[model samples]
Target chain A: MAAAEAAFELPPPTAEEEQWRYGPINDFEIESYEPSVASPGPIQVPTEGPSGAAALEAASAVVTVADGWVVNIEVSADAAALGLTIQAGLNEPRTGFGEDADRFDRLHEAFAPPTLCISMRDGAELETPVVIRSHHTGQGRACFPHAVVETGEDAGLDVVEYQTSTSGKGFAAPVVQLSAGAASRLRYVVVQELGEGIVQLGRILCNVGSQATATAAMAAFGGSYARVRTDTRLVGRGATGNLIAIYYADQNQVHDFRTYQHHDAPDTQSDLMFKGAADDNAGSIYTGLIHIHPDGRGSNAHQTNRNIKLSDAAWAWSVPNLEIENNEVRCSHASTVSPIDLDQQFYLHSRGVPPAVADRLIVSGFFGEVVDRFPGVGIQDEIRRLVAEKLDRRGANQ
Target chain B: MTELVITDLSVSVGGNEILRGVSLTVRSGEVHALMGPNGSGKSTLSHVLLGKPGYEVTGGSVSLDGVDVLTMPTWERAKAGLFLGMQYPTEVPGVSLLDMLGASFAASGIDASGLSDRLSEEAERIGFGQKFLSRPLNVDLSGGEMKRNETLQLGVLKPKIAILDELDSGLDVDALRLVSRRVEAATEEDGLGVLVITHYNRLLTELHPDRVHVLADGRIVAEGGAEMAEKLEETGYAEYASAKPAATAESRFASGGFDA
Candidate 1:
């Protein structure tokens, strides 16, 4: 599909496209919603908000963006001494994403309030993480929020981004761009908990430099139809990238994920692990690719996607693909979409665990493999709580 | 004292009878060893007692203190003080052994407070590391480690009766000793009833049984005291096999018994 002359004029993505297949694109309408043009006034922390600020007690900086507008920003003294800066708008020109840019990306580029930029100085190793809370609210409104995270050479940085909502129905397209410099260490975590009536199309593009390590973890447990596309490129020698995600959808919800691990340089490595579960009448789709370019000799990449269906009506699709153009590289991909293992259940039952409790434990253990690999302390606990909540909800419904 | 009674319990798989007419009685604080050759119906008896799926109960009644247990589910049977030490414990990834034991205790109406400390103490007594308690249950464990893990649960749960199936299959000399000692300690402490099932008498040497029963072709062909086990150790099950009856449909079906 070609880019529209104007971002607002771009048409909605159709289901015919491979990237949008198995998604709820046909139900989307870009023209029915109005863009968020004016700010929503002074910022006040909403106590009832999902993934609220109270969870992050040791954050070095806290920034809240509501309705695609930056409402508040706070930085600690320690963060300032470490040469960390948070700007409201982009510092440089925003070049359009070339050919692969879709209608949603263009729409975000044209109407997004401002690009929030987080920069870490060289050799700076900040002990505390920076928390960014992106909230979308208002009915029949569309919002685009973008953030760029850049780290200087040999720097160490940690960040947690929370995407949440207040209103019952809305549309949001949030984009985050991450660049890890040479020998730097970067960890970025995103938690999405939008309302059930909301629709979200989010993206995260990360580039890893020579000898740098970048890990990106996302936990999605919200939205009526939430889809996130991630692209991680290893552009320098010996770079490593880890992509992890855990999602749960229940009661007419649909969670979709697409990932790309591109090994473009020699000896680079990337590993992707995605796990999800669907209960009630919900559904989930996971499609990922591990692409090794010709110059990616000696590169090693692996992709794994696993899902569990908790009910006969619940559905899940897992498709993992690998494209290797280098003969010297080693690559593998694995995917599974099945119900819980009976043997595992029997093991629990034989130990005197009741059936209902056994199901919850098995599902929690299913997602535990990915949750334990995540980096943030507060966010990991929140993810566990949210998973348990989902399980409890299922138990109540049944 | 609690007692488990199995009267004329007959089991079949795929329309072929395995245990034609088996009967046994095990009381608390007593240990009975069930010995049989490879083709005999030893493991099948333990599995049927535990209510493992796919084994049909053709005719029989199993009662734990006057409660008919054949109609109960697997977990219900466990909660009713029935335990089966599996030959091959299933690997449950991401679920810690501590969590499993705690949950089991909770389901069985036992207080779960201080479970971690209790597990740690048991680990110390058995020479097992505390780290194993925090690790996933049976995940990535060696065969010997899996057997020892089962023994740990057997000690912790302290069921009224435990049918240990092939408890010595994968243990080294030291591990077998450690595991058997743990079982003996549990019996002494809790007055636990036990039915030890094995193809060899090596395990029985460490954990002595009050009585021994030899099962040949799904029938109790011989029964005696510790002397019987000593005699079998010298002559083996070859004499019993020679005296075994001709191959009936059930015996032929027993040839291809459930191995896993």
Candidate 2:
């Protein structure tokens, strides 16, 4: 409980820093929202709460957290027999996060609450996913939670984490640390669907080991101001890391994303694609870099960021950079920010599709490409439904 | 019983007067051929009718069945039974042809029950396989395939008046014949009024329009029967221009000849 007060005394991240650009550091004032208790009492888990998103329904384990407190944990007996472990918090102090650490990282460290860790043993193969659902209730209450996940050598697993915020003002800050072992495969999805009055800041650090493959997919749709910074480190030879995201921001909301793809070893590969749409007065910002160190010879990395503005007042900014020190490496980054394609509008309009309907179809079709790439996640249809609902809400407000 | 009537229609693009006082009419069940050489405002007329951006209507009146269409939006005009088979179709990335057919058919007030069978029948009628309906709209389609796709939309949409802009240009002989036959068939089956804009007489021969009007310097300079098109093919627009009186009056000319 004393740690929560001490964490607030720490200074916030300054806007001038390179990593702070377009971040919600200025929008977050912890004093405005009530901070969650350091130690919360056991919660009465609601039987019929926010549930059954296909991604969560297909999981073998479900962990539900209420206001930074873990109240429920469920794991299948079959998965338990395979040496899958779900525990609370790290057993030892961690190290090795240097340049990626910042003031936000320090703040989360000082106020870290009940931590949830999901790990799989060596050679374990899971056919179903493990889901973590975090619920933020209470008006103006602040919550800080930490999560850690690890995949053992030669093992494969899928994990999904979704955040849901109830009505009223609040703040949520969550930090996640994840890694894949040698020759392992890990697919992780984090979906942010907060309520309208909340502001969220989340940081994720992922490490891919030798000959391993890792994919981190995120879908962000809620929050008054939402920002995420993701860093992926290819630490071992021949590792592959893929980062993909799809976001839709409507109304007066703002979404920011900063990603780093670091290739530290030889023959590693990384690819990233982030696509989003901003409507009404909503705005989005994306800045990413592909960094290849001297030892990352023969590495290939590509970064692409695309955004579509759905209204006259909506805005989007995309900045993609590359830092390659190895002459043998191949790395490139590209970005595009524009309103819906005029050609697409004309084609639909010529067919007698009204202006609004035409824009809706084109926007849906535009985001469909990104969502279709993740059919394995089984959340594409749900994402589409949310987009339609958001568009309708925007229409009604206009 | 719908009629497309244009009176003293003038348009300008980027402050340049491309179309000056153009007037023509096409009633349902009738086909009118509009011919002109390069820079003669034939395409401009089509765009202005569709109210495409960047083209200002300096002076004009366009009506469909006596309803003023000049103030209507492009989509409303389309729903009001006006269709333009564009000379250059735009490529859209992710929208499939089936999705387009469903939305477009509904816009035209068609009952969309069993839309699959209707889309298949329309694709087949245009010499396109049913699988083509699953493909994205005009993306990576060859020039011939794009033309066929345009005609396919015209057939299913069943517009009262279709302004086919240079359907013969940039098309191979086979594609040109196929597009021509499809438009002709659609006209007969849907009771469509056709306004075919072209510079070549090849399509004019196949179309055999009820009326042929030659546009020059943004105005119709000659008006006559189908043979007028064949005569212009022989003399070309250069000789046709000098043969005319060069007057801006609303003068009517005799068939196969101009009053200079």
**Top-TM-score candidate index:** 1
Chain A only: TM-score per candidate: 0.96, 0.93
Off by over 4 Å in 2: A1-10, A39-51, A90-96, A375-377, B107-109, B231-235, B240-260
lDDT of 2 by residue, A278-347 (tens): 9888999899989999999999999999999988999898989989899998887889999888767877
- Expressed as tens digits, the lDDT of each residue in A1-398 for candidate 1 is 12334654555678888889888899888777777867775555453436555666788898888887888888898998998999887573345266778778887777877778888999998898999887787577788887888889999999898888875678988888889999999899998888887899888899999999999999999999999999999999999999999999999999999999999999999999999999989999999889999999999999999999999999998888889899998888899999988888888888898888888888999998999888966777889988988998988876
Name the TM-score of candidate 1.
0.93
DockQ (C-alpha) of model 2? 0.59
Interface root-mean-square deviation of model 1 in angstroms is: 0.9
Tens digits of per-residue lDDT for model 2, B157-239: 88899999988766777667777788888778778999999998999877769989999877787888899989988988986
